[model samples]
Target: MIKNFKWLLLVSLSFVACNNDDNTTVVEEPVSSGTASFTKYVALGDSFAAGYSDGALFKKGQEGSYVNIVAQQFATAGGGDFKIPFTSDNFGGLLLGGNVIAGVRLYFNGAGPAPVSGTPTTEVSTKITGPFNNLGIPGAKSYHLVAPGYGNVAGVASGKANPYFARFATSSGTTVLADALVQAPTFFSLWIGGNDVLGYATSGGVGVNQTGNLDPATYGGNDITDPNVFASVYSSLVTNLTANGAKGVVANLPYVNTLPYFTTVPYNPVPLTAEVAAQLNAGYAAYNGGLQYAAANGLITAAEATKRTVKFVAGSNAVVVVDSYLTNLAAYGIPSYRQATAEDLPVLTSRTFIGTLVNGNPAAVNGVSVPLADQWILTKDEIAEVKVATDAYNVTIKAIADAKGLAFVDTKVIMTQLSSGGIVSNSFTLTSAYVTGGAFSLDGIHPSPRGYALIANAFTAAINAKYSSTLKPVDLSQYSILYPAIIQ
Candidate 1:
């Protein structure tokens, strides 16, 4: 028994000694503790992405940019300071809000009266702040991002002349986006390509005249954005951003024709007052009779009476209603009976012809029925095209984000909800309305201050979710009013 116990004790001692020697090193594995450590962020996009609205580059509008608001919140939550290159300064220059770039002004100022036909009145504003955290360029298209001389064409600047990017640029003459990425941002938010289709919608189709009337010739049958070009620029941008560990979030484009500017224009021609109707019909009749008289008398080409619209200059006179105008009038009156003749209608659309009432009664000449002209609404074909393009863009955005394990900001859906009155702020109920409503400004394309805050909150939520960081959203209530056009 004693011999057995001794052998057992020896065996235990040997086992303990062997284990101690083999497990000498005790290094702990590294943890994912630094998971929420993104400090620097950059944002890139066009005007809507820039929070440009109303007629000017005001502090209120600029501060409303979702990117700026999110950056401020991030700073409080341990993010590095994210500065924007903006231009919303109180310069004391007394410039009107929408006319910063010398466009969209009174009739005498070259723009003529606000066309009764709904047209966007806002041109691009200046870079109030730039080379900034907000690298949103006005009037920029998708391909324009890498296009040379873009900075110079966009605005005046220090180095290569991109004042907007120059303000925040580390080098002279570098583009705002390129410069921002070169700075090695840890994170980025990109919302681009809205203007690609937006311009087409506002221009009322391509190849259309600037005469402020709806003409089919405008659809010059050209697709402005080349899919290949879009994919290349977008992929390159994403690649560059992630090259330096920049986690990115990209948003999709919205349907351009769905906005208020296009939605509110009356579908029918402007009505006329009884007196004006009589005068117009009388004039038309006289003109018709004269035409018949001239034709019957073989009095053709006798220095044809000068057309009121066309000027006879340097003794050069030509009488030609030609086929274009005549065909247009005949087709309109007979088959469509929708549009008004050039002689019958003013050069521009006007609310004045909303038509005064005669004896407090409203009706067309001879009480004849008139068809409504569909201007604001996109035709079925146009809508389908817009949908297809938007879908493709969204697909690209999602695929890129997923492939790179990044985030995506769906501003397109957000905007649609907004236009449909889905948003509810303290002082605003955003609808697809003009400046009268808080949803959009006189431009009918861009959002008001409240709308911008909503966007900021969206970005903030996405960031919080992805990084496991608890960044609080800005209170929509805190956002102030944007334009005086809105009623209290």
Candidate 2:
């Protein structure tokens, strides 16, 4: 009886030990800061870095910026606070003194993008106190970063200062670089040069390609930045940021042509019935006759005349466009008119104007009869110029990043992937399709919140590879593709 009792006690003790082992918690390895320091992070660039989405800089957009998203990941690995200059409300746009300068944010009203009905209360004159982390200014070019008086509120009206920068600059005379340097950032990210060419592209090539021009002050708001100027300004920015032994990540500019803003609208968007097509062809009969006459008279080549000839079909037809690159036949009372081809890219804003009647006259259709002006479409030549400038800027960016020993994100490659086919991130495939792509916001240029998350992962991956860090990427599913009209 004693031996049996002892055996039962031993069995009970063993069972208790097994139960305790089952309930024990396993410890996880803490996230590491890796070789680089992220105590003070500063992001420098244009609208993308500022988190400007749906066509405006608002509170929620700023929060969803890739900079803030990366900063959040950095927090787990010893990164400090990342301060952002938040707008007054989710309603974007700005007020200069008492007047509205910029427009409100765009939201999809089931059918298409429309402005959110509300007046923006964020005044540019009302400055925010800073040493803020994000130093991104919308509409800023490469040279604007180092230009003095770029943040002066008084200079906003004269185009001397950026209104976005004006709201957060430490003083009236402080440069963006100067303000950033004051913080002595341990880490940083620079993604400028987009706005430099973006203005030229978005304006449908109305701006000059200032390739040989070095003076930025003499350049127009829509001019493509000179490669030399970009190189010099970019190098200076990287040098100053790293002067204090700071490590950072830099991204190369993507070709703006790949964004949905340029790709969404088809060149042959005009659909016409057989009767309407015949009428349109009749309207262009005189122009086609002029081309034939020019070709026969040796005023223009046969191939050139054929290329310039306009004809409409029963189905979808290409819109007429003013191609300035064509030979000037104004001496013969002929305009430089030609039908648009697949190579041409129409600006997104042209969609609203393309099918509309001029002065409510059904016979005088804008795109079909009146012809689209140069400001409405980016011709093939214009696209070539933009590509050349973009490629040059990217080369400089990569070289400078390599020289500075910074982690590099090839946004160009990422954009190409998104434009062609699609890219899968965390089981979700994202494309460059306008509204349903799940990658771009309603503006068609800036990335959606999920798109920003993808970019953050890219930055983190680059940082991890360069610094040997184990930073985990955020789940892309958590982000929304579009912001609601009303924020709760």
Candidate 3:
């Protein structure tokens, strides 16, 4: 009887020990910080920084913004809370005073892109109270961030101020930089100057490339900003932001043409049959004959005549064109006509404009016969102009990063890798292949949520290297690739 009682006691003790093991809590691996303070993080930039996706800024985009992602990681590394000026709804609309200032977000509506139904729930007149973390304003240029009256609500209607800035500016006449400075940020991310070059490229180089001009006010909305002007404004911005001994990160501009927006459309998209091609060539025969005549008469050099020659073929071909820059060759009846070359870039919006009938003639398609205007094309010269400005801006940014002992995020190299082959992150690959690439949103220029997460990781790595912070990188799989076609 004593031996049986001892066996029962042993069994009960083993069962109790097993029950205790089942109830034990497993502690998660904690993220550590070497010595970085992210108590207040502020992000400053243009559309890309503002979480603008699907051609608009909305709640979901703001929620998944790279800055927000960084803030979350910062929390793990002894950082504090992060806040953003979130738009009211996922529809991405905005109202000012009482009028609709911006339209709703774009969604793929089975057939094509269209705005979601309903007006914006957020009203700009009812401004949210201040000291928000993310201060990115869409349509802001390098100079605009420092320009006074940039946030004046009264100036919104007159084009004197940016509507996006006006929506969240603390006062009527405060500049974006001023508001950012007021926050006394411990860490900041400055990604301005993209618009300085993007405006010219996206406008098909129609706007003036104000390369030599240092005055920004003289520049138009689509004009390429003067690199010197960008440097001056950017330097002043950094100097003021870092005067209080704050550490931050700065990023150089990416090659804008690499995104799907510019690469998706081919330069020579027009195709024609043998007979149709012959007919099209015949139509330009007069211009071709005139070029030869001009070369014979020596009115223009032989090289000039050849360069301006217009030709066509059966399969795929480019259209002939005339612009303000053709050497006034009306004497030879050349009409400054020349076929678009491979170096030209068509605007993404041209997808709809191409292949339409010209003058109601089916055989004479628009792209086949009616040449696209300068606004629809970026000539090789225009692309070169953009490159020069971008290079100069990058140099300035690098110099600033070095001088201020800040982290330099080489966005150009990152984008190049994304465009060339593919970037691998956490076992997933990302590319710059338009909507299907999983990196870019439907807008083709901005990154999707997952893409933004990848960017956040890059920034975190840069921060960790420069500031000795132990911020854990975000898992790319957690963020979304694309929003649903139609949200509930």
Candidate 4:
């Protein structure tokens, strides 16, 4: 009886094992590329493409450029040699035919920002002949890339040439786009038009918007390029890059105001003692009284006058300002005066002057009784202008991507994410904050090595998805956050 019972148990166990095997699920590995290729890759863009970090384009920065990172990944998938117009040192600046056209990189000396102590070693006259892979110019705009003689060393003196390009142009009169086309790439990536709106934003709207002006020559260094001009230039670029039937990836611009360079300094940065606050308010009494009087006289609305009223408290408070938008009331013995609101963003440079005494008055600081100048603040209206232009440019870019059937990387989305909730990659969180954020460098405008790695991953994903390629994404955690000054 015992033997029979054991036999039954064994039989039941065998039946259960067979059922488990039949119900087992199989998981297939992710699919890679079907027809995509990265035989010869080229990158065309501005400073970000050149790896201009910490406000300088040095050797290490160039090596860590997002394009370079992408190219390195391409190498694993049968990509060819990739080259850059590498500067001699990691200190950035370049000598244009023996003159300093760009400034040195910035570093933290445990105090504030200071220029890296070194003479530039990259000479513009020393040309690196190509078919080069990394064709990024540090300061090139959308139109500048297609403009003839933009890389001519002789044109540098006349402000028609980019110093960064002069260092590596195949010939004196070649445009950046033409030079890039000469490479005959199998895969390409473009990230232009940033400087189109960046200049206006960085200049605190000191430059013209040039909204209706189609001529690129008439635009100032800080002016915003017309969206039509951007469209024409951008279309020309895509048409030429794709002329060879090469697949490519393109990235849209991020709102410049979201960068640490503009957002680092808060609007309400002023902290005053009760006594100092009272004294400062007393000094503004005349201006406040004038505003109220104007409101009563119908010179300005009572609500506007109230909105422009200056007030200070012992704790954190917004600094008063003389905005350019205010109506000139000097004829009425009233100067257009107002206090800065939460919407205002003081330029990063304003931090140096905010606490400084105005005309040697300790009690009256620059941001206090003196009021910050229009150039130091990005007013709410100016921000609106930036937004409009950004939107228009992105529209043009997306349209081009759709028409060309190329991969598109939405940088603005990721940038906003980085600035707000931050992004986690490989269990590491990276923000858009300067220095410590491990995303942006000391300059706050450009990204650090890790940040570039993140961008490279974005490009890789887009390329893999659009072209049906299996190119692996770069591991962000492997890249260094920031390079040391000494580079030991």
Best by TM-score: 2
lDDT, model 1, position 220 = 18
Q: TM-scores of the models, in the given order?
A: 0.62, 0.93, 0.89, 0.90
How badly does each model clash, as a count of residue pairs?
Answer: 30, 0, 0, 2
**In terms of TM-score, which candidate is stronger, 1 or 2?**
2
In model 4, where is the ten-residue run with the lowest total lDDT? 209-218
lDDT of 1 by residue, 174-288 (tens): 5556766666788788887775565555543332333221122322122445556677778888888888677766777777644666655443443445665455445445444
The CA lDDT of each predicted structure is 0.53, 0.91, 0.81, 0.83
Candidate order, TM-score descending: 2, 4, 3, 1
- lDDT at 350, model 3: 78
Quick one: best lDDT, which candidate? 2
Q: How close is candidate 1 to the true structure, as a TM-score?
A: 0.62
Clashes (candidate 4): 2
Q: Can you give the lDDT of residue 24 in candidate 4?
A: 77
- Candidate 2 regions exceeding 4 Å error are 1-26, 208-219
Off by over 4 Å in 4: 1-33, 208-219
Off by over 4 Å in 1: 1-38, 88-100, 103-131, 153-173, 207-223, 272-379, 425-429, 484-488
Clashes, model 1: 30
Please, what are the lDDT tens digits per residue for candidate 2 over residues 9-103? 99999999998899977777788878999999999988989999999999999999999999999999999999999999999999999898888
**Ten-residue segment with the worst summed lDDT in candidate 1?**
316-325
